[model samples]
Target: MSEANKDLMEKYMKEVALRRKYHEQLVELKGNIRVLCRVKPVLKEDQQEEGQAVVVTTDPNNESALSVINKGKARAFELDKVFHPQATQEEVFQEIGPLVTSCIDGYHVCIFAYGQTGSGKTYTMEGSVENPGINQRALKHLFNEIEERKDMWSYTVNVSSVEIYNELLRDLLSKDGEKLDIKINPDGTGQLHVPGLRVTEVKGFQHIKKVLAKARRNRITFGTKMNQHSSRSHALLCITVHGTDLANGSKTTGKLNLVDLAGSERVWKSGAEGERLKEAQNINRSLLALGDVIQALRGNQTHIPFRNSRLTYLLQDSLGKGNKTAMVVQVSALESNVGETLCSLKFAQKVCRVELGPAHVTISFRMTRDAMPYKTSQR
Candidate 1:
């Protein structure tokens, strides 16, 4: 082998040794795997009698239509009223930020969005371009916190996004073919070769916002009864955080995974057929696989079955097996979706029970030829 080949081989070997060490250390991490739920918005029916003066008799700050009519109780199993359902995306972020911040300050954290078909998972995670979503809100907040602590620390952050379809990686940014296989490098850097998909490094919020806006335009969408603009694909948006306390010089690496899972659907209920049918089946299949992994994780099963689906496999490292995870189960308040509502709540409940250990955030310090893994904080 040539000298260059020998160097690459040495680097690859070092990468493997580092991962093996990280894996072993992962067993000691104890995580805060929590799931939060958001309520969908609503509008009072246009004055039923078109020309009559409408006298509103209810409190503006009153409970949801269901809570009002159901005497403050709905069939949705994990329905929580401590937090409002129609809460804005920012409101939900406020409710969840502290919990996640706690993990980042020194713990492992994974935050993701989950819900049934058209229940507003997309709106909650990656909202309309006109109105920013959770990802945008979180990025802004992270930077704000960093700015406030400027005298005490310096931080670096990098982001990567990918879509897993049919157990394969489909680079949403790629202009070439439909899909490509992702090889997770031992150095903790993911490799992508799809003709059009690209991972851009972001230094500030503006750059990220621009990319997010473009990504929103490129996100997969399809029509359905629950939502005419429902998302047909899952998106994993990860922020790798690196911090060095200027005061103590204690370096910390942390990662916050914000996932917007494709809403789950049924053929009969969604009236999905043709390409829609295939998409629904693929979605349901992957979600079921996710459920299985969660179930096994809760029971402390030795074999996690992540290999069953691309979604689970890709999330393997973040779902309590290694990373500290959080899930926000979003549901619509309309009576039309009581069944889906309950299902989403239950999924969140199951997710809360799984354990996670200290998560060392993976970030690249510098690169001459390729990846160089470095560690950062617990929270």
Candidate 2:
């Protein structure tokens, strides 16, 4: 490499390192849990007139303030950040990019999308091919960080995907589609594990692409009056990063959990019945359980109800103390969705108050089973 190019690269790496350090300190000072709000534009299928009123409004001067109309009353909510409907996928990811890359530094991170049916939760978490969302962007960011630090660090990334449908856990990457169970670590680590779940060692972006495509194909989705392609299951993509410092012979492990939760639905509005009704019921129950857990955490309760549902059970580690977490609440701006949007915003307001404490970096020589959390699968 030319001397000039080498100098430029060194300068860039220094900048990245400095920025990362600053973000780490900032996040620590603010606590671990962050809540961001995103407002999605009305689509053609919404069937609203061209000049129809928008019930949700954002303050141009204050990016963190969101207001919505409910029963002719204006209610305002404050979050960590707010994204307008015109915001691009790249813009959304930029804010959380540090959280995604922090896994390399051995900080556990969890990012999930939550909202009512057809509120663009899935789109925000897993966007279209041309404008890939957080899941794709996070993987790429991690890979790039690995490459940039290859001189001093050796990293291994393991990927796993699962779906909780009807209160049952199914391995998304397993060919058998078998039901999986979460087992507490026998070593007294107090960590949860999923036996026989497929874990793939990812080396490059191509491997990530194939795994994500397969996961999306395996996820369950169905049509409803509110949404034609409503996701009926909560999907989690777990990326575990194992890093070894060559200089000191020390090791560290971190996990980045990318979750796309099934949107909460209103039964009367969605017109759900039969099997669809069952799925909706399960989804609502799980989401309610998650909210309960959050409430318990915020209040510093004696017991956290993680075992109440499959979704919360699987995410116990990430949502617990000493880990960084972020939630993106997507809401519709249409007047018709005002009621549901209010519910979503109120839930997000509650989420903003939950503090999970400062995050810590894991440094150890022994490889923890919970780091991988699943069985290695043959590709």
Candidate 3:
């Protein structure tokens, strides 16, 4: 290393030590979090008005015998598109590259989507079968950035995916016919109990895509009245980034989580049967638990209650604990779903109130000053 390089290394080492000590002091400081609310374009047929905005002043119990039929179909572009038009589903895909890059640049990140059934959470998270989505786009970008910036930095990426099924954990990457159990340790690291759920380490985009395809096929999906192709289980796609700042020997570890939550549907509207009903119960219950956890965090309650739900327990390490978390709330613009949309909005509002600790990124510095050599001679 050149003299200038050595000096820089020494300076960085000192800075890292200082930051490590400060991390303890600032662990309680709130993190930077923001909510992005994207309004799904309303379909043409669902845009009809209630003719008279019908004044059904009937009973405190219910509206009987009279139904004000919407005479027209809703349009897809009825939403105020000024600032909220969804990224063409394509534009949205393009946005993930920079988001993941943010993590590699030394920020712990979590990006997840929330929306009602039939809304477009899957489309945003996994994308259309024919087109790529954010997950693919981000991985592709990570590799491309690595290859293109060969002289700048070298990266190693590892990815794993899992699903929360009825409060139980399942590995999404498991073999088609095999069942995998998920194990969570007290130290906070999780593992798949079954050997079939292989967490693969990937180098390039193609390999990552192949793994994603197989996982998607194995993901738990079920049909509901609200959405013909709704996801019955929650899916988590994670990418672990490992890199070395060749110039400064600053080793950084970053991770990005892309979560697709199960669709939210009412028991009456979904017309769920035995199995579907069970799935709905699990999903709604877990989501409620998550809400409570969020509320507790916002209130700074001594007892977080994360252990109350498996889903919340698994995420305890990520939220409020120095991870950069971003949530996009998706909602249909159609008035028919105003109730669901309202619920989603309220959830988003609650999420906005929650504060997070400053994002803490791990930086391991390997310096020549700290290096020691071992020499051996055999006689």
Between candidates 1 and 2, which one is better according to TM-score?
2
**Predicted candidate 2 versus true structure: per-residue lDDT over 1-379, tens digit per residue:** 7999879877876775697688789777765777889999778888556766788999999999999887788998998899998999999998788887777888888898998868888888889889899998999999999998898789999999997778888888876567899999898998899989999999988889999988776654222322434377788999999999765688989999998888775674558678778777888889889888776766667898998899889989877767888889999998878888888888888767555343232333225534665745622
Q: Given candidate 2, what's the lDDT at residue 36? A: 89
Q: Model 1 over residues 1-379: C-alpha lDDT tens digits?
A: 7999879867865764475456435423323344556656544552334443211122236332222223345332332222454466677776556544543454445666778756667777778778767788888887777776575568887666676654556554444314655456556555322334465767788988877655544553312222434356677776667778664488877666677887764555757567667777888888878777766775577898877887776666666554455566766655555556656666665555444332232223234223424333321
Question: Residue 103's C-alpha lDDT in candidate 3?
Answer: 65
Model 2: lDDT equals 0.82
CA lDDT of every candidate: 0.60, 0.82, 0.62
Ranking by lDDT: 2, 3, 1
lDDT of 3 by residue, 1-379 (tens): 8999979878876775575456533432423344555656555554576432321111223211111123343212111111243347665654444456666655566677777877778777777768766677777777877786565467788888877777766666755424455456546555323344566889788888888887776663422322334366778887878888766577878778788888776665658688668878888888778777666665566887777776776666655545556566677655476667667766766655445332232112334323536423321
If candidate 1 were superposed on the true structure by all CA atoms, what would the RMSD be? 16.1
Q: Which has the greatest lDDT?
A: 2
What TM-score would you give candidate 3 relative to the actual structure? 0.68
For each candidate, what TM-score against the reference? 0.66, 0.83, 0.68
